[model samples]
Target: VEMMENVSKYRYANVPNLDAQVVEIPYADGRLSMVMMLPNREGLHSLQTLFRDLSYSPLASTLASLRETELLLQIPKFSIESKLNLRPTLEALGIKDIFGFDANLSGILAGKSAQIGSVLHDAKIEVNEQGTVAAAVTGISVIPLMGSTMDTFRADRPFLFAIVDQSTGSMIFAGRVVQPTWAAPSPLG
Candidate 1:
């Protein structure tokens, strides 16, 4: 288990809708960040339901509202990685032609006959005191894509998180942790 059972300060914010205080772990570049959402209560699914109810626009706005606060942060050390074959999921989104027998990916390869046999999205991230290191590689695929002053944002329980792109306001990588040792293994592994 990646245990981050230590206390430290970070940029924090109190978000009303999520009922969680947020802490931003910025990258060296500042264009991206690791946004962790630690709910004031132990209701992780409630946080999920709120996001599902509000959609992402509200999320982008919510993130924009973060400010500095003194925070006693207690979060676990975890690495999140996932590999998923996007064929069925893509097809469900009306992207069938690409997976069809006569699919046309001509524009992709000059004359070679090639269909998008399968699209896989592999993403992983690691976060710690020295800052956060993250990367996402979408195999033939494509894809936080913030916080403030004195507050206690202890994530000793399940919570949600995302790696967002500041400029585009898109979540490049996002997931929730139900277990500390196994990243998102409780439900996602």
Candidate 2:
């Protein structure tokens, strides 16, 4: 497979640079594949935009080569949002039949546990190894009164909403909120 060939080449190259050129090769199965080191969010976005622009280039051979080849894009764990954006970007590049997992499914595919609570009730604070006060983490807790009855309070999780570039793995914007609002759709949800 193209992916396997790219892995072999990567193993052979001893001193690869951060922004190395993409490699192309023809496989025994008569298929072409392009291999390149994955870029950060900005770089990925730039590449997507560039491909979109070149989709209708006059150079038929270049365009044909791109059309015939498969791509293996690698990404780290934290770049989920950016990866999500790649779908629309690919569509803009004239790629009509692309496939990928949705955010929640992708998380499970990547072996990440999904957050399944409706409310964050208790918050715990601690210091990290760097000696800085770690951000408060929220959990669920319940308290009971001696005489009257049961009462509970819903708390907020310590997380921020962030916009990211899918290609190059960059956080474009971020904001914190008091509660989980439905204003934005969460892939995790």
**lDDT, candidate 1, 29-59, per-residue tens:** 8798778877666655766664564464366
Alpha-carbon shift of residue 41 in model 2 (angstroms): 9.7
User: lDDT score, residue 189, model 2?
Assistant: 4
State the lDDT of candidate 2 residue by residue for 50-134, as single tens digits: 3443345322222223322222212111111211345455567875432423225343447763432222233222112111101
Judge candidate 2 against the unseen true structure and give its global Cα lDDT, from 0 to 1: 0.25
Best by lDDT: 1
Query: Model 2 misses residue 48 by how many Å?
Result: 3.1
Top candidate when judged by TM-score against the true structure? 1
Q: In candidate 2, where is summed lDDT lowest over 10 consecutive residues? A: 1-10
